[model samples]
Structures are given as structure tokens and as C-alpha cells.
Target: MMKLSLGPILWFWDKCTVFDFYARAAEWPIDTVYLGETVCSRRRELKPDDWFALARDLKSCGKKVVLSSLTLIESEADLRGLRRICEQDDFLVEVNDQSALQLVTAREIPFVTGPAMNTYNAATLKVLAGKGLQGWCLPVELSRHTLARLIQELEAEGLDLPAEVFSWGFLPLAWSSRCFTARHYNLPKDNCEFRCLQHPDGLSLRSRESQELFRLNGTSTLSGSRYDLLRQLPAMADMGVSTVRLSPELQGMEAVVQRFDTARRGKVPAFDPLALTEAPPCNGYWYGEPGMDRVARTNAD
Candidate 1:
């Protein structure tokens, strides 16, 4: 069975909301939960101690908790934070940056690579597997065929790292040093006032034709369409995906978890649905098409 995972919260929420959200999640059917600040370092709604506390609580509930590192580390403060996560042996750390990878691998800390890591082939997976890699998430842009090929190659070489797919979220397209959210508000990067808190779901960018194009949250830009793979779970299961990750949203998360849980348990076809009821659902990257394009599920939905 392909286990369901809740990716770290991508949107900025109040500290109470984050705690309350996880408190509720402790009872959800999710098998794995990733905790951390993956975007801008300025948003300090939760400190390192806070993340550790939450990880302990979640672990007590029988959930596998993994601390995730920042995608774009820019300073010594960020490096120190990554060291804290890598040095700890209590939970697995998700490496999203090259610096984190180097630090963790050099220390022989067993970790997993996130979608942001530049792991596109079995050769990269092989190298990381030797460096204490417990698992890895495929880069979001790779297609089902690509994953199938990589899996086939890995198994042929007898290097079977657990495979995870970014099954649902606003596809994180890229990262930049200058926060786009701050730019949206015409505020400089340093004094941006943590304005990402205003847009919990991210600031949506649309083309002049009113087509949803992208979303800006802190230093990252995501696709405007929420990439959904509920209907494609059966196919992924057949392809031997070990896990499916759903990025956290402020609202409707419980229902989203429940829906994926139900579908994964039965290996059944599911109607593609959006949790927050805004952007149209997309699965184009999974089908080797432009990520923004919505590819209909041939078998269902």
C-alpha cells in the first residue's frame, strides 16, 4: 500500500493555528508528517524548540515525524538551523538544499531528499542511498514514465530507496532570494513585515487572459493550479510508489487527508477535488505535459 504523507505547511499561519492543526492531525489517518520552516527564514511563527516539541507530540501518536530543512539557505543562521535538525537522531530530516545534503551526508545522518533536491536519475538516488538516504521524493516535474524508469533501474541495481511523489499541492516551481510576496507588497526583502501571513494560500498570479498562472509565497513560486493525484493513486500504487505527499493547506486539510486515506486504503478511483475550493486541479506533470495544464484522468474523474 502507498502510505499517505502530509508535507510541511507551505503557507504561513498563526502559531496557534499550526499547533491546533497538528493536534487535529494526530488523529488523522496520515502515516507520515513532515515538520519545519521550508521557505523564508523571516517567518518565525514557530522556533526550533517549537518544531521539536511538535515532533515529539506527533511521534507519541504513532506518526512518523520528519524535520524538513529550508529549500534556499542564505545565511549562517539558516546553516545553524539545518545543523540542529541534522545533528538530532530522534527523527529523519528531509534535505531540501545542497548544503543540508552535504552536512547530513558528511555526518552520516540518515535522511530523505525533498522535491527541491536535484535528484533526477537512479544514479543520483544510488549515490544518496549510499550516503545514508532512507528515502526520496521525486522532483515534481518528472512524469509517471520517468518515475517508472527510475524505479526499474534502481531495482535492477538492487538499490531500492522508498519512492515518494508530491501527489498534491500548488506545484512549487522555483525559489529566489528576493521574496516575491514582499515584492507584491512593494516592500524590500529585509523589512517585508512577514507579509506572507496575509495570504495563507499564497498570492495568486494570473495572466491578462485571467488564466491562473502562479502563486507567490515568501521566496517560492508555485503553480496556480493545485496539483492533485487522488484519482491516480491506483496507477501509482501499481507503479510501486511507497508514499504520496499532500502539501498542507490552512483549511479543509482534514477532509483532504480523509479523502486520500480512503482512496489509498481501497486502491480505488477517486474524483479529483480541490480542498480549498479555488484553483482548478491539475496532474499534467505526472503525464509529461506542461505543469499548468489540467490532464483529465482517463479512468476516473
Candidate 2:
């Protein structure tokens, strides 16, 4: 059966809200839950100890927990945090950057590569697998054709690491040193007053004509439309996708998980794309088309 895992919360939420969200998640149908801050290091509503405690609690509830490292390591403090995450023996670590990968490999720890790590070709996957890569999240921009070829290449090389796909949620595009959210508020990145908390979902950046183009989440820029692959579950299964990840959102996450859970069970649940998200759905990247195009799923695709 294909597993469903919840990605780490990308947007900043209050400490209580984060706790409550995970507390509810413990009872959901999700088989795995990723914990910790994967974006900006300054969004510290929950400290290291707090995240560890949460991970422990989730594990006790029978959900596999993985601690994710920061994507952009700019300072010594960020490297220190990455080291601490890699040092954990109780949970798997999701390496989001090369620095984190080095730290984990130095310790000879098996780690999963996050989507931001850019495992585009089989060669890269083989190299990481040689470094104790247990699994890898496919980069968001790669198409189904590319993934199929990579899978074939991996099989030919006798490599058998599980492939996890970011099947849902806003696609995180890029990260920067300058916080677009802070700039929107006319504040410096150093003391931005945690303004991201105000918009549970990152502030949306729309075109002058009012078309949603992108989302500004701290230092990360995300696709404006939520990437929906609910209809492609069967295709994913046939492609040997071991797990499908659903990025956390501020609202209706339980329903989203339930819908995916149903689809994974070989049942095609009714899914209205627009109702599930603030913006329309997009699966063009899966079909090797424009990232924003909505392509219907078919066996041919």
C-alpha cells in the first residue's frame, strides 16, 4: 500500500496551534509525519526541545517521525542546528541541503533527501544512495516522463531506494536571504517581528491584473496554486512511488489527508480541487507541461 506522510509546516503558526495540529494528526490515517522547522531558522515558535518532545509524542502514537533540516544554512547557528538534528538516533533525518547531507554522511547516518535537494538524475541518486540515502523526495519540477526514466535507470544499476513524491501542496520554488514577507511589511529581515505569523498561509503575490502568481513565505517562494495529484494516485502506484507527501496547510488538512487516504486504498474519492485550496489545482509538471497548467490524468499521460 502507498503510504501518506505529512510534510513539515511551512508557514508560521502559534506554538499552541502547531501543537494542536499535530495532536490531531496523531489520529489521522497518515503513516508518517515530518517534524521540525524546514524553512527560516528564526521561525522558532517551537525550539529544539519542543520539537523533540513533539516527535516523541507522535512516535508513541505509532506514526513514523522524521526530523527535517533547514533548507538554507546561512550562519554557524544554522549549521549547529543541522548537526543537532543529524545527531538524533531515534528518528530519521530529512537532509534538505548539501551541508545537511554532509553532516549526516559524516556520522554515517542513513537520511532521506528532501525535495529542495534536487535529485534530478539517476547519477545523483546513486551518489546519495552510496552515502547512505534511504529514500528521496522527487524535485517538484520534474515530470512523470523524467521520473519513469530515472526509475528505469536505477533498476538497471541494481539500486532500489524508495521514491517519495510531493503529491500535494504549494510547490516550494526557491529560497532567498531576503525575506519577501518582511519586505512587504517594510521591516528588515533581522527584526521582522515574525510577521509571517499574521498570514497563516504565506502572503500571496498576485500579478497586477490580480492573478495569483506566487506565495511569499519567509525566505521561500512557493507556487501560487496547490499541486494536486489526487487523480494520479493509480499512475503513481504503477510507477513504484512508495509514499506520497501532503504539505501542511492552515485549513482543511484533515480532509485533505482523508481524501488521499481514500485514494490510496484504491478508491477514487470525489475531489473538487478548488474547494480543497485557495487557488486552482495544477499538475502540468507531472505531464511535462507548464507548471501552472491543469492536465487531466489518463493512462497515456
Candidate 3:
């Protein structure tokens, strides 16, 4: 059976909610859990020690734990935090930035690259695979065809890193040094009161036609439509995808996990996973189309 893993939380939530989510996550039918702050370092709801404690707790519950680093490292302080995560010996570290990758490689530590790290071509994957790369999550923007080719190339080289796909949740499209949320509130990034706590699922962005376009959260911009791959489980399995990642959201995550778990076990979920998302569902990038376009699953695409 394909493994089910939870991606690190992309949105800022209160400490209580963070702890509570993990409490419930321990009992979910999840094989792996990623813990850490992958976005703005300022959203420090959980300290490094706190994340390690959580990782250990989850590990104790028989769940594989991975510590994720920030997507965009902007300062020495952020680098320090990334070093701390990479230097640790407990859990596998998910490298989101090149800095994190360099740190791990320098230490000869085994690591996995997150979606944000953009491990697209076979050449990059091959190099990383030789340099202590345990696994990699396909970039969210890559299509299924591209992934299939990458996997074939890896097999040709006898490389054996597990391939993980971002199978659910809103796609994090871009990251910036400036916090868009703070800018929306007309506050500077420094003095910007932590307004991310107010928008749990992220403050939505819409076009002039009132079409949901993107979500502005801290320094990251995400797809307004939730990127769901519930119906693509069988296809992924056929393509030899070893793991499927479900990004954490502020609400309805347990239901999301349940549906994915059921599908991974060869059972069709009774309800549509799209119905659980706050925004319209999309799987465009996965289908080799525009990021917002939805393509119904068929044999080829």
C-alpha cells in the first residue's frame, strides 16, 4: 500500500491548536508526519525544542517524523534555525531551501527535499540521491508525465529514493521576503502584528471578476483553489509513487486524512474530498495544464 504522510503546517495557528492537531494526528492512519515551521520564521508558534519534542512524541507513536525548514531563508537568524534542524540527529530533515541542502550535504547527513526545493530533473535527483538523499517530494508544479519520466530515469540509474507526491491541500505557489499578509494590513513586515493567526486557512485573494486566485499568508502566496488528488490515488500507485503528502490545514484535516487513507487501502471514499476544502478543487499542474485548471482524471492524464 502507498504510504500516507502529513505535510508540515503552512499556515500559522495558535500553539494550542498546533499541539491539539498532533494529538489527534497520532491516532490517524498516517505513516509519516512532518513537523516544523516551513514558512515565515516569525511565526514561531513552536520553538526548535518544541518541534523536536513533538517529533519524538510522534516517533514514539510509530510514525516516521521529519523536520521541515523554512522555504525562504532571509537572514542569519533564519540560517541559524535551519542549521539547528539540519544538525540534529533525531529525525530526517526536509530541506526546503538550498541552504538547508548544503548544510545537510556538508555534514553527510541523509535528508529529503521538500516540494519547495524543486528537485525536478533526473540529473538533480541523481546527484542528491548520491549525496545522502533519502527521498524527495515532487515539485507541486510538475505534471504526472514529468514525474513518470523522472522515476524511469532513476530506475535506469538504479537510484532508489522514495518518490512522494503532494497529493492534497492548496499549492504554495511562491515565497517572498515581504509578508503579503502584513502588507494587506498596511503594516511593515517588522512591525506587522502577527495577523496570520486571524486567517487560519490564509486570507484569500480574488481577481477583479471575483475569482479566487491566490492566498496571501505571511511571505508565501498559495493557490486559492485547493489542489486535491483524491481521485488520482490509483493512478499514482500504478506509477509507483511510494508516498502521498497531505498538507495541513486549519480545519477538516482528519477527514482529509481519512479519505486519503481509505483510498490508499484500495477502498473508494464515500464522499468527495473536494467537498472538504474551503475553496474550489484543482489538480491542474498535476495534469500538465495551468495551475488553476481542473482536469478530470482519465486513463492517460
Q: Which 10-residue window of candidate 3 scores lowest in summed lDDT?
A: 269-278
lDDT of 3 by residue, 1-301 (tens): 9999999999999899999999999999999999999989998778999999999899999999999999999999999999999888989999999899899999999999999987879999998988999999999999999999999899899999899999899898899999999999999999889999999989999999999999998999999998988888888898889999999986788888988998888886656834654688899998899989888778773
Q: Which digits, one per residue and each the tens of the lDDT, describe model 1 over residues 1-301?
A: 7899999998899899999999999999999999999988888999999999999999999999999999999999999988999899899999999999999989987999999998999998998999999999999999999999998999999986989999988989899998999888899999999898889999999999999999999899999999988888888888889999999898898888888988898745435444484997888999999987888778532
Worst 10 residues of 2 by lDDT: 268-277
- For model 1, give the 10-residue run with minimal summed lDDT: 266-275
After superposing candidate 2, which stretches have Cα over 4 Å from the reference? Answer: 270-277
Candidate 3 wrong stretches, greater than 4 Å: 270-274
TM-score (all chains, Cα) for each model? 0.97, 0.97, 0.98
Cα error, residue 261 of model 3, in Å, equals 0.8
lDDT (Cα, tens digit) per residue for candidate 2, span 251-277: 899989999998999997665543754
Clashing pairs in model 1?
A: none
